[model samples]
Target chain A: MAASSRRDGGAAGRAKAERSAWVLLTPMCLLMAVAFILPVGLFLLYSFYRFRGGRLEETFTLETYWRFMTDELYLITIYDTLQLAVLATLLCLVISYPLAYAMWRMRSPGLQKLIAFIVFAPVLVSVVVRSYGWTVVLADQGPVNFILTRLGLTSGPVSLVYNMTGTVISLAHVFLPFVVFPILASMLRLDPTLREAAEDLGASWWKTFRSITLPLTLPGVVAGAQICFTLSLGSFVTPAILGGGRVLVLPIQIYTATSDINWPVAAVGGLCLLVMAFIAVVAFGRLSQYSEAV
Target chain B: MAARIARAGRLPAWRHLALGIFTVAAVVFILAPLVIVILTSFSAQSYAIFPPEGYSLRWYANLAAQTTFYVAALRSLILALVATAASLVIGTMTAYALVRYRPRGHSALKAIFLSPVVLPKMVLGVAVFMLVIKIGFYGSSWNLVLTHTLICVPFVIAIVAASLANFDWSLQEAALDLGSKPLPTFLKVILPQISVSVFISGLLAFVTSFDQVETTMFLMRPGESTLPIEMFLYLQRWQDPTIAALSSVLIVFAIFLLVMTSLVLGRRKITTLQTSAEPQP
Candidate 1:
């Protein structure tokens, strides 16, 4: 009888706990449903709706997607978006790996902390401000151009800003801290003894790094790359400010379409970005798993 | 062992020199724009010219004269504070429930909660804009506050849950056994222990909300822009050094935040990156 009562008490406690859990979760669920899920669903629905003469018709159709697939304009926009993300992510990785490796290999704690702090400092500032700063820094007669001219690398100032080059450079700068921290985290979590063992085995530093450290930290690289790609894919501000109307990516298209009240076009363009971001996330997830397995 | 290897100079001296040079170059690349902005703010020229022919505080004076930025800065500040507070409260409850109760489908539920972090903010912005338009809640400040909260709550939940994962349940149990209620038990026994995490999360959430441009852009009504939006629109119209001055002030604010975060984080500075730095054992 006593054991049975104890079991009954346990069941009652669990029931109460479940009730409390639901209560705590109620606000978040409501917020997501009302704000996030509902809105995204509406976006999906709008993609199927037709926009006739700047008016949104509630009837469902796949006209927008068909147009997106067939139109060279949209096809180019999608291609450019992917290209921008790819280039920015590549730039981030190229810069971050060496920087993270240096941070990991540093013997001085003070210098390491300073470097980490410096890398992270930009993240705190607004992207708009940073993009604007880049424009000035890379402008004609700006420091970069001034230096290049002085060095006789170019007889004339280069048109760096107001172009795809500026957009990619600024995007890479904006996402640099995000990429570096992940790689650095993985390096910090690395097993030191493994490296010592490799060294004792008379393995060269490069060989040990290639055989072990690189593979182990590949997951971090993948994770960082995922962040950079997704952020670049959705980045509207830096590209808007730095792209100088010359680089027309999907986000810019969506913004223009939305402003024009062309809901179908906006929805279609947004869906493309979502699909791209999702693909990158999945691809990176696979790479991270593969790296771990190896 | 790793430090010992580095100290014993297992690598060639040239490699160290190369790494040192690369690090310096990377730092320059990272800081060039920011430093240049501060320098340009003091430029005497009407247009931005590097290594200015002369220096003056004219731009700072011009920035002070622009009242639009002042209003927008105030709006951004209040909005960020409200969003941060709301997210902290809602997120703490959610984290506590998941950690303490171990509810069914806990991992799945957690994933759903964090899904917003991965969802493009631009999409979220457009989606929320459509919803508000549908519900006729367009032009409401609550819309911005709620959307910002949605974006920030994930960071709060992630950090608070991580902190709570390490919390001693014995204290809460003891408090309950002593006839204390759940809310009071949490307040007295749990909150103090996780206060640091809570503060860090709040700080981070504030920054995230304050820096929001992609998400807040569509929701804002005409002439009621946030600070970043105002700056963005202003840049679209002009490329003068007045913006450089405002950006300098913001850069100073960022430095202050960096210092505050470092002081709070102390030795476990890794926690600042804990949102993504969940080191697998």
Candidate 2:
């Protein structure tokens, strides 16, 4: 009888705990439902409505999707968005890997900490400020152009700003910290013995890094790439400030469509960005899983 | 280990030299834009040029003469503070429950809560804009507050949950057994333990909210823009050094935050070491 009663008491306590948990979670759930889920749902729904004759029409149709599928301009924008995202992600990986490796291999803790701070301090500044800075640095007669001219790399100031080059450079800079920390963390988490073992087996430094370090850190690389790709796909401020109205990425297109009061086009453009980000996320998730298994 | 590696001579000296040079170049690349902005802010010319021909504080004076930035800054400050306070309270409760109870479908619920992190800010901006307009709540500060809180709460939940997962619940039980009320016990015992995480998360939430532009862009009424939105628009229209001046001020603010965070974290580390040295009960 005593044992049965104790079990019953345990069950009752668990039930009470569950009830309290629900009580605690209620506000957040309500907020998410009303503020996040509902808005996103409405956004998706807006994609089906029609926009014609310079106004939004309250009707259900696939006209927006059809246009996106068939229109050459929209197609080019989609292609450009993907291209930019891929290029920026690749650039970030290339730059961040060597830097992260250097940081990880550093012997001095103080130096490592200072380097980390330098890498991360940019996050606190506004993206607008950073993009504006890039505009100046990449502009004609700017520092980069001045260097090129002084070195006789170019006869005149090359057009770097107001184009894809400027956009990619700035995006890569913005996403650098995001890329570095993940790779650095993975490098730190690696079993130090693996490198030592490879070295003991008379492996060259390059060979050991290739066989041991690189393989283990592939997951971090993929994770960082995932973040950079998604962020670049949806980037607005960098492209807007640096693109000089020449870069026609999806986010910029959406912004234009919305300001033109073309809700359907805006919705469709946003959906394209969303779908692309989702695909990248899933692909990287699979890659990370495979890397872990290896 | 590095010494051993050096002795082994498997790696060529040139390789190290190459890496060191590349690292310095990369750091320069990272810092160049920021340095340029600060330098341009001091330029006498209106246009941004390399190696400014002359220097003056004209842009700083121009920035001070503008009333719009001050108003926008004040608005951003209030909104961020309110949003941070609300998210911290709500997020702490959610994280506590998720960590302690391990209720059914907890992972699913947690993921749903954190889903906003993956959603693009521009998309969220349009989506919430649509909702607010439809509901006739356009231009309301409450709309901005609620939306900012939504974006910030996920970060708070993630940070607070990580800290709470490491919490020793025994102290809470002991407090309860001593006939202390649950709220008071939580305040005295639980909060002190996780205060660092709370403080860090709160700071992060404030920064995220304050620096928000894409989402705040659509939600804000015309002429009532946040500081970032104002700067963004101003940059779009002009390339003068006045924006650079404002940016320098923001950079100084960011540096202040960095210093404050380091101090707090440094103190926390020392306290943790001291606690570890204390005799157990």
Candidate 3:
């Protein structure tokens, strides 16, 4: 009889704890519902409304979506946005892989830490500052052009800024830390015994790296690529400063549409960007799963 | 055998040399822009040019005369502080509850909280802008604060929850068994353990909020902007060295933050090492 009563008391205490958990969660849930969920829902709703004569019309029309699908200008912008994102992701992976490999191979922890700090230090600075810095660095008479001219690679200054080339380069730079850290983390997590076994079997260094290290770190590559792609898709500051009016990506299109009071276009353009980001995320998620299974 | 295998796995000296050169080049690429910005800030000329025609402090003087940046900086500092404090409190509570009890659909709840990280800041800006206009809360600082808190809470929850998951619950139980109340037990025991995560998250939250431009742009009243927004607009109008001067100042501030973070992390590492070395009860 005593044991049964004590069991009942334990169940009561657990019930109380559960109740308190709900109470703790209520504020966060309420805040998210009010500030996040409602706003996003409203934004999505606006995408269906019509924009005519320089104003928004509250009619339930698919005109914006239809136009977005059919318009050549919008199609070109989407193409450019995707091209930029893909190129940036590829570039980030290319640059970060070697760097991550080097960091992983470092014998000294102190040197590794210092190198990691150097790699991550840029993240603390504002994107605007970084973008502005790139504009000067890649300008016609800037240091890069100066070097190229001096090296006789080109007789005159080359136009690196105010174009897709500059945008991609700057975006890649902005996302390098994000790419490097994940790859480095996965490299650290790798089992050394596997590599040793591969070597003991008379595999060359290159062979072991190719068959063992590369395949195991594929998840990190996918993860980093996903981040770079998604971030590049919505990147505004770098492209805005570096593109100098030539790079008409979707985020810029949305900003312009909003500034022009074309709310419907803005809303539709934003949704397109969101859709692209979502697709990249989902594709990379599957890739990572496959890589991990390998 | 292991030593032989390791030796065999090591790369040739030439390969290491090549990689070392590549690493140096990568670091240069990563740091070139920042280095140029600082160099440009010291340039006397109006245009950004290589080798900076001549050096002067005139741009710094120009930055000093611009009162707008000062006001914006102050506003950003306060806003970030308030947002960080609020998010830390609310986020810690939610993280504690989620980590301890793990109520039904906990993963879903966590996902909902962290979904903002994936949402484009531009979209969030416009969405909240529309909401504020519709609700007649336009030009309100409170709206900005609340939105910032919403944006920041996800980070805090992610960090704090991770720390809380690894917490030893037996200490709390022991305190409870000694007749201590739950609130005091949490304040005295649970908090001290997770405090480092809290501090790191708070710093991250502050930096994120302080550097925000996309979200803060749509919300701020005309003529009143955050430092980043101010600098962004300034850059749009002029590509002069004054902005570079301002950026240099901000870079110095970032360095300060970096030092602080390293100190905190270093101290925590030492403390953990010491604790692990001590004999357990």
Clashes of 1: 0
Pairs in steric clash, model 1: none
DockQ comparisons of all candidates to the true complex:
0.58, 0.44, 0.43
Location of the lowest summed lDDT over 10 successive residues in candidate 3 chain A: A1-10
Per-residue lDDT, model 3, residue A122, is: 82
Error of 3 at B249 (Å): 0.6
Q: Which whole-number lDDT from 0 to 100 does residue B227 have in model 3?
A: 92
TM-score of each: 0.95, 0.94, 0.94
In candidate 1, how many Å is residue B280 off?
14
Write model 1 residue lDDT over B1-281, tens digit each, in one string. 67676747656799999999999999999999999999999999989886799999999999999999999999999999999999999999999889877788988898899888878788889888988998899999988998999999998888899888878777776787799997888898999999888987898789889989988999999999999999999999988899999999999999999889888778876535535332111
Can you write out model 2's per-residue Cα lDDT over A64-175, one digit (the tens) per residue?
Answer: 9999999999999999898889998999999999998998888777777777778877877888999999999999989999999999999999999999999999999998
In order, the Cα lDDT scores of the candidates are 0.88, 0.86, 0.85
What are the per-residue Cα lDDT tens digits for candidate 3 across A215-240? 99998788778878887898888888
